[model samples]
Structure formats: structure tokens, C-alpha cells
Target: MNTITDTSIESITIEAADPDATREFLAAAFGLGGRIRVRRSEAPTTGFRGFTVSLIVAQPSTVHSLVGTALAAGAVEIKPVAKSMWGVGGTVQAPDGTVWKVATSAKKDTGPATREVEKVVILLGAEDVGASKRFYLDRGFTVDKSFGSYVEFETPGSPIGLGLYRRRALAKDAGVDESGSGSHRVVISGPAGTDPDGFAWEPNPSEQ
Candidate 1:
């Protein structure tokens, strides 16, 4: 799949220890509309998973609403909703151990709270951000933006967005220690197979 051109992650399949509970939690909390799939797996995963799925929305109210629903749906709050230099957001660990970031760029409420998600971003924590960025580019992923330690891929029309950041920095952003061993416990679809950073990928089922 090295020649993959004009690509985006169609969806991600999370290998859950408790598929049923995880599915229910996801449905009630974020209503991912099946973009997040689950299957049973006992793979050992601890601490940070080297990745996070971020929900970017239009306003702070949506962030509050989403975070509140996530907590009510059995997610453990990793960070309380608060304003940051970037905007407003928070973190939560799903019942199945997936770290999720709910965020918005707007500082104030645009209107009433609504469960609307503007984008679903999958950010991979890469050991060598520059190398990984180059790897993805060689695989035909368009660069939306890039800086010293971060790269965002152009994923137009994709249900799941893609980006890469320095591993240590990513952990800091997630408010977690950067020490963890074992599987990431998830597989995504963009370019099939694993990348240099060990992020797993499979053929997008939707394209089958």
C-alpha cells in the first residue's frame, strides 16, 4: 500500500477487553455512529496507548456536553474541562481503555449545547515525528500542516482525521506519563499494515 494516494483513515477498530460495555459506552457518550468498531482482545495494554482520538467541535458548550455525557456513560475523567491556550477541552478514558480528547477552538458558547462533532482526529505519538511525517508523505498522504514536532495530514471527506506528534509531547498533552509497554490495542485504516512508528493499519472495511 505504499502507493496509496489521496487517503484518509476511514475508521478505527478498537480491540476491547469488554466489547459490549465499550460499545454501549461509546454509543451513549459520543454517538460515534459506528466509526469506532470493537472486537474482543486480551492484549496487554497499560498506561498511554501512544494515541488519542480527539473530538473537535464548534464551541465550548459542546465540549462540556460531550465530556459530561462521557463521564455519565462510565468514562473516567482524566482532565476537567478548562480553557487552554488553544481553546477549551478535556480528557477521558473510555471504559475500554481508549483515551479520548473532547475539544473546541471557540472560547465561548456559540449557541445552546449540542452533541455535534466537527471532526474525529486520530493523533499518533511517534518516536520520531519528522521521520513519521516523511513516511506518511511518501505513502501519498497530503500534508495539511507541519511544524517542528507536529504534522497534520489532509484528510478531506474522512470520518477520522490523522496527525502525528512527538511521543513525549503527545503524552504531556494527554496529561499522562510517557512510559508504557504493550500493544496500542487499536487498528486504523489509511495505509494498510503498520507504520514505522508501530501504529497498526488494516484495509478500510468500508472500501471492501
Candidate 2:
């Protein structure tokens, strides 16, 4: 009955000649205005030399607009930004060719499970899990489970989960190599009684 497989867009990577300049410009233009992590990477001896990848808080409803504006300003659009039926997302590419994507989330709670799930978790992969944990923890994220190769942040009233893990393992899980360095975007949905899937909110008491 199903023909297409694996339709969700998880992550992406891009190459930039001047990663720092591009990062600063993008952060300002997109109003990311959050704690950003910068890492120096080598290899892929073609497009990138020294670069920075920024991970910002993303919500599903406005993820597309956030990325679209940045891409339109200075970032190049590699993949056409779009949303999915299950309320996930895929928006990648930025100026300097740095890749960024809005976070994608799981399907609706179709089971008899009531109680109204308010949020979802987002997971990311990093080379140094410990360092990354400290980085996020310093930025006001409530860190949990510090023994494994991964770390998670519990953000409620969202559709996607927020987490970080080992880059090699993350790439392996996604069937990709972890040698390249670039920005990635992710989106999480909003709480109930709100526009979880829809956007452009006003004072809509009827929808609420």
C-alpha cells in the first residue's frame, strides 16, 4: 500500500568559505539570538576550512519562516523548504553554503494514550558529548542522563524532542558520514489549544 519510504527530513550539512562571517551574519539576520556552539573542523578539502554550526531553538509552526527568511537574505537555498503530513519539517541551506534545517517531529498520538502530550524531544550528535552537555547546560537546558554517549534536554509543550549525542553514532544512525561540519536546523511543535500545525497566529478564540 505504501510506495515512498523514509520521508522525514532529519538533518543536513553545508560548506562555507568564510564560516565565521557567515555565521555572524546569519545569526543576526535570522534572529537566532541564542547560545551558539562553534567548532573547528578539517577535511572535505574543497568548500569549507574553518566554520561554525549554530543550533537554535526551533518550533514547527514558525520553523519554515525562520529558515526561509535567512535563506532569502544571504543563505543559499539547497533544499526547497517544506512540511509533511505528519507535522514534521525539512528546511536546509544558508549563506556560505552552510546547511540548516528546521526540526522534524513524530506523528500524532494515535494510540488510546490520553493525558495530552505537550512536548516532543529533539536529538543532535556532537563529537564531544561531555563538552556539548556542559555547553547546553550552561545555556539553561536541564541536562539528564550523563553516562551514555548521548545527552537529552527536556523541553515541554513541544512536538519534537531536544537532545544531543555522539556525531559518529548519529551519522551512522542516519546512514551518513560524520566528518563534515555545517549548520543544521530543527523544529518542535507547540502546545495544545494552539496552532501546532498551522501558522500566522492572531487572537483566534474560536481556534483556541
Candidate 3:
């Protein structure tokens, strides 16, 4: 089914048990530039929520800065920051059960650590990458790249970009197990609906 295809990602709502504390953590840790929101929800959820929010920054310093702050804010380190063929990055799981990955394409430090974030990509774990890609295409999203088990959608000017990855692969990448049930405990505000993989969304409050 065609979910939110042509929509712009205004923000993401992280359904949290303690909204106040979670909000504070996100603000102090990632400072995602107002791209994240939180609401109280006791919905049963466990393991990997089948999604992860990524902080795509410009330099390695920024990666260290963001990940360091996240760790200091009580986020558990899932993967240590280090350089790889794809650049330097690492993963962490927030106290609220949300997985976050901080990464940069630059291997070398560019000047000093800055709070500047180049982009944020919401990666949804998909059962079938091709099927999900078609769903988005039918709805209206243009493909930036689609190869093997990954598909990235072009979302120019949007606060958050979208991508699809195999569920198991996504969980492995986040250093978690692909075993989650109950509500995802997260909502994509701009899309305002549920996708094929049971990923949920809600209308952008600003648009409403």
C-alpha cells in the first residue's frame, strides 16, 4: 500500500514512558534541531523497535561530539566510534529504548567539533526492500538509490530523510536483536500513517 509518499518529514514523535525526561535527553544529547518530539506512551515494546534514527554529520569530530554527549546523557554504548571503509561511526541505545547511530563521511577531523548536523535519516527495518520501495514509489517518493537490501528516498528540504533496510540487517547494524513486539513506540509525524512493515506515523501537527 502507498503510505506517505510525497510528504515532507517535518518531525518524528518518540512515544516515551516519561516524556519529560526523554525530551530532555534528546535535547541535551543530539540537539536534533527540533526534528524530534516525544509523547507519553506505555505501549508494550521490546528488543529492537525495527527502526533507528541516525545523525549524519559532516566530520568525525561531530560524530564524537554527538555520541559522547549521548553516552554522557545515559545512552548505552552499543558500538564504539571508529573509522571504517564507510567512514567513522557508532551506535547507541537511549534509555528510552530508541536506537541512535552517529556517523560522518569524513574520516579526518575537520577543524573542531561543531554542533552542526548535516542530515537525519530515519531508517525503517523492512521485510522486503523491493516491496517497500515500490510502496513509496507508488505514493510519490523518488528513489535516490536502491541496491540489494537498501533503498533511500530523496527528500530535499525535509527535516528528515527516509530509507529502508532489511530488518535483520538493521538490527545487526544497531547491535540489537530483531525481536520486537507491541507498538513501535515511535511515530513518523509527516507521513501520519502506518507503512507495510507496521511502522507508524501521524499527521504533522503544523500541517494540521
Candidate 4:
């Protein structure tokens, strides 16, 4: 995936009972209510670019915990918890019911240890070493030391070494077939033409 520095937003989604609540949640979250409108609704609705809404609920107790959390945060509750046609859930009045989801999830974290892992430098493949350097330089990226034929670019807060590699070579390192020279081309876009390609990725607004 090509990631740009200062890319603003990528996607927006909403989920709610009244559509209006979804929109209002998004409005408060992104502060884009006055300008962009791209929400798709079965009824009257609204949308915002780079927004995504995902609604998931499990047991009634789980839903209550989520609702309680929201209420504790001073969020206005619209309805009491009850069993709906779908399952147990409740509707909350938001600035835009049609914008974002105001529900809880039935998921858990049963994975590995939650130890911190920093920096996610994207690996870009390049053909010409000098040309690739020049391309990145022209785009304002400061190149790290050149290792053999491969070159590196710095992305703030990235934990690993982010660099440009020979497509075939990197593929071999990752145990992927990279025999074809022109197999892949990774583009690192920056804001405007001045912003350098940085390796910072934030949480998607819709998920938040």
C-alpha cells in the first residue's frame, strides 16, 4: 500500500439506527460536517470521505458496558437497552444518527503478548539505485546510507529500517519469487510535492 505523509484522511464509515446519529458522531469526530457529505444510507443519511462505521454487538451485558462507558463520558443516551430484531442493542442520539456507529463489539484480544512494537517502515522496491534516490530526494525524503545496491529512507516513529530494495533481492529475502525485474513498483506519495514520505500511520477515524 502506498502511504503519503500528511495524507489527512483515507476513508469514513458510519453505522447507526437513525442515520442521523451516525452522521453526528462523525461530525463530532472529524469536524467535517459542514463541507463533505458522502454517507450512504437506506433512509435519509449523510456521509464523509475517509470515514467508516462498523457496528457489532454481542450479549446484552456487553452492550450495556459499552453504553455505560459512553454515558460516563457524558454522551447522551437516547434509548434503554432492549432486545431488537437483530439482537440486544440500544439507540443513542448523536449529532448525526446517520454518521457513525454507537455500539459495542463482541471481540476479544486472545493473541500474543501486547508488547510495544514501534515504527512500520514500508519497503519500496526500486530498479535504478541512483534514479530512485533522486526520485525520493526530489520528493524531499532524506536517504539513509546506501547498502550495496539498496537505499533507505527515514520515516519518523518507525521502528524498523525502511528502505528501497531491489525487487528481486527483497523478494528473495522474504522468500517470494522476484525473478522478474519489473515485477513491482512501490510509490511513496507525499502531501503536495514538498512533503517528504514519512512512515507514520494513525488509527482510522471510523474505527476510533
Q: What's the lDDT for all of these models?
A: 0.87, 0.42, 0.87, 0.40
Candidates in order: C-alpha RMSD to true structure: 1.5, 15.8, 1.3, 16.0
TM-score of each: 0.95, 0.39, 0.96, 0.35
Local distance difference test, candidate 4 = 0.40
Give the 10-residue window scoring lowest on summed lDDT in candidate 2: 192-201
Deviation (Å) of 189 in candidate 3 = 1.9
Q: What lDDT tens digits, residue by residue, belong to model 2 across residues 1-208?
A: 2111111222222223455765676565454322222334442343321222323333444445555566667765444545456354444445444444544354332334222223323355666778666655654557656547866665443333456657676554333345654323222222221111111112212222
For residue 187, give model 4's deviation from the true position in Å. 6.6
The positional error of residue 47 in candidate 3, measured at the CA in angstroms, is 0.8
Off by over 4 Å in 3: 1-5
Indicate the residue-level lDDT of 94 in model 4: 37
Number of the top-ranking candidate, with TM-score as the measure: 3
Backbone clashes under 3 angstroms, per model: 0, 18, 1, 32
lDDT by residue (35-65, candidate 3, tens digit) is 9889999998877899999989999989989
Off by over 4 Å in 1: 1-6
Candidate 2 lDDT score at position 198:
15
Cα deviation in Å at residue 119, candidate 2? Answer: 12
Ranking by TM-score: 3, 1, 2, 4
Give per-residue CA lDDT, model 1, range 61-117, as digits (tens).
999999999999999999999999999999999888788999998999878888999
